[model samples]
Target chain A: MATTSIARPQAGVRPEGGGLLHRLFGRQPAGYLFLLPWLVGFLGLTLGPALASLYLSFTDYNLLESPNWVGAANYVRIATADPRFVAAMRVTLLYVVLSVPLKLVFALLVAMAFNRGLKGLPLYRAIFYLPSLLGSSVAIAVLWRQLFAGDGLVNMALWQLFGIEGPSWISNPRYSLYTLVILSVWQFGSPMIIFLAGLRQIPVDMYEAANLDGASKMRQFFKITLPLLTPVIFFNAVIQTIDAFKAFTPAFIISDGQGGPVNSTLFYTLYLYQEGFGFFRMGYASALAWILVVIIGAFTAFSFLSARYWVHYDE
Target chain B: MTSSAAAIPAIHQPAERRALWRSILIHALLIGASILMLYPLLWMLSGSVRPQDEIFGSSSLLPSSISFDGFVRGWSGLQVSFGKFFLNSLIIAVLATIGNVVGCSITAFAFARLDFRGRNFWFALMLGTLMLPYHVTLIPQYILFLQIGWVNTFLPLIVPKYLATDAFFIFLMVQFFRGIPRELDEAAMMDGCSPWRIYWKIMLPLSLPVLATAAIFSFIWTWDDFFGPLIYLNDINTYTIQLGLRSFVDSTGQSDWSGLFAMSTLSLIPVFLFFLFFQRLLIEGIATTGLKR
Candidate 1:
């Protein structure tokens, strides 16, 4: 799908070398007309702000004053002096590394269960997906905060089920971030749906062939299904990694926007937001934003580069 | 099915029974897991009806004596009525949905069907924008809107949709439009149909599934969006439902837990209804986007 989409424009490239001006101003003016909204948005909203942010990263703008040139000072300060920045980065990296893999594993397991052609599979899928639909909302985050409180339902369950007293999950510094990670893992429905589709796409004949060789079900999965499903896994990993980095709402709402209890839940985006909006350190925040872009870009590039070894595409 | 049953020997009954047992065990596990998964939501629903003091006091999902007090107090809200917030969210969500559906479809039509110079470049640029973190654009976009006096208005939240700033929807529509047979456009063109007519009559009608998908997503995302309203709209009068809920938590130990849960349950109704009605399209959209190959 990726290769075919990239190859499409090449097919449209004219063989004959038309004049540069002619090629520049094609006959299809209506195409440009159709593209008017996106073009204006691209320049005015996206590209314009993007360029402004790049410049803002090097300045000391506080939104109250004019931006002053301070070449790399914000970046240096963040790298050298900012404890909260480091904490936020550490928190976010831990979140991505922990939540994403756990979520993906759970998603794959559920998808495999659903792929067994369960009756009322649609109903189950919807039931499982309900959390994801509500997961990012302020309401859910608020609910989550209460649910993990000392006297909340989770602790109540812990006491009733095992006679063990549970601590306040949201208040304790050690457990606060894990609560958010659990929230993330609960919303694994999107990836589960994606995995289900990928599982469906695997040829049934391959499984049958494995069965004819007297391979066990686990062996069939390991030898046949896993290899075929690697591409989807890689795709989900890259997307989820980026998503986990940008996570904000849960942490923000759960910690009441302070990243409370020693900054355990201070996601990178939340910290960036605090610097930019809450503290009015717009330039520092812009620098943080650029760093995030670089980090996400690096992860994406790394996944794509490593994909060649593991992600299989059938010819 | 009959042939398979006939081919199996009558002595294979124990094996079939064992398969049945396995199936029963799987179902039991799934049912148990589903209950655990749905418990929080159910507990929230029950808590909404429970008395204020009884909410956290008892962990039981069933309220011994249910009351409408939470709903009444929550609806009345702290300073402003929840109705106003709901209206604010609805207006923004509806406008954003319409803007995304119309603008994204048109942009996608141009990219997928119309031939023009720099088309590929623009398309690639649009795709690249998908990878750009919203944080990267956050400060500058806020500053831009602030300078333009759109800070305290819905314009910051809604206008971008009209300008097709959501490249994800545009990309989805593009993929959908590409799947549509080009011969339809050719056939229409041969019959004296203009590009506008082709778009309005053929593409728009044929692309209903994707358009509906985009519209539903736009509505849900906008309705649930807290950060945009948090940054843009400061006035409580103009606050969305999310902001209203946030305001309920004073963060100094005086949160209206019962009222918050009531309002939260109310807030989820539209989304729940939408999901129930459009489950197939929603699932298909997620599946097709991820597993296009």
Candidate 2:
């Protein structure tokens, strides 16, 4: 936790004065040696590919052919002519907007309940967390499709309880994305765990003091708990937003890998996959990939910029 | 003492009763929510045991007549047996987990214990990669692997792990490593231990919880990964459990619904069992990662 201090241990002892080469290499050769694997990966796997994608964004590369330089044509096309790109953006944004807030709210509420110290709390927490662990699996996505099928369990429940026949939640365009949002919210365990940790970190004396001073439970939560938990909330917000933007498997599986039923669940990542692998439009997919990075970066930057106003970090 | 207690009994009795009622309400609510949360999983289990016709025909939690046909057919898989896919997944997951544990811990130790030129700068760069979307690196990495003839093999998935491509685990381990008191390392150094010896004998042994956390996550993620294998592996023989499951449904129309459910249940068993045994470590891993920062 106290990383900054640990990293500055050598500051306490001055190195003997030496030539430039000695000073550079002699002080910590083993440190760099230990870091060799990550350094190689950072260059070859991450940075190299990342930069190559930027170059590929302006090209016309298919797997079958050598990449031909196009110089901004891909970006121009996405900006102007690509209706599916716009649809994908719209769908993805709608998803991020709908799912992130809903998921965080559910996570916070459930976390608060669990923080109440009910008996068998560990069992409850583990059971609640089971979904998030399995949520991304193709198996679960397949199960989700079956559950929301026209004659599936969900529809059966609707018929039995409300005498209303439910539409095929996966097939219908209007409600298809909503089903994915529900799925996202259902897997709120990760954030709920974080929130529980944050709740535990809040000093108990603050609550007791507030209670003694005639503060109601609701007032205490608003005045003390919520403010103290803002940092955790902010962290979850950024991570979940990025995660929602990158969401693919559920939509891909639910739509049977086509992003189908008239592109209702065509998440941006799924569309990028289709463009890259399915259509062999590698350059276009690369461009789409950069756009996703930019969009996520912007969202993250905005959250951080806004965080100073609300996030209360202890001094 | 008896006289005073008897005099106050009437006053405290109602309060004690109210507390009992409150506890009962809380337990009742929690139990209800737990059932709702677990319903989908239960349904899948029941569906896997039920006959094919009754899967979608009935909404009941229990089957009227339980059958093992789904399990038998599902294990036979579409082209290869499901056992092969499970083995494939296990091999890849285990290798990746070992790679992550070894590589990430080494990297994290350097970050946590050593002071070097541009250390903070390098650390910042590593954290920056965490925020960079994976899609940004997807195409070029594919092309790189394709050029090296690593495509359609497990190398693409397994190699990066050996290089500690997952910065999240490194960050987690670094935090855990930093929490270990510097006195231990200093004392080892005083006893003429080299950095390597300190890392091997002291740091690694002390950092087991974080390492376990990283290993477990690495295994589960690799085992469940679909997009990575789907893009890289064109051959059915190289399919992981996820890719195998995907093959159960024909994208155009038909699916072996019962068989799919049965196999899906089977696929989840490993993860479920792991979680059941190591729930404490898993929860601690997540909690520590989130709260430490």
Task: List the DockQ of the predictions in order.
Answer: 0.49, 0.51
Give lDDT tens digits, candidate 1, residues B58-123: 777899888778889888866888899999999999999999999999999999988777899999
- Candidate 1 off by > 4 Å: A1-24, B1-11, B251-255, B291-293
True contacts kept of each: 0.61, 0.61
Kindly list the per-residue Cα lDDT of model 1 for residues A131-240, writing each as its tens digit.
88878889899889889999889999889889989999999999999999999998888899999999999999989898889999999999988999998899888888
**Residues A1-315, candidate 2, lDDT per residue (tens digit)?**
232223443322224344464377445556788889999999999999999999999999998988999999999999999999988999999999999999899889888887867778988899889999888898899889889999888999889889999999899999999999999988888889999999999999999899899999899989999999999999998888888998999999899888878988999999999999999999999999999988888888899999989999973
CAPRI-wise, candidate 1 is: acceptable
User: Which whole-number lDDT from 0 to 100 does residue B42 have in model 1?
Assistant: 89
RMSD of each: 4.7, 3.9
**TM per model?**
0.94, 0.94
Off by over 4 Å in 2: A1-21, B1-19, B251-255, B291-293
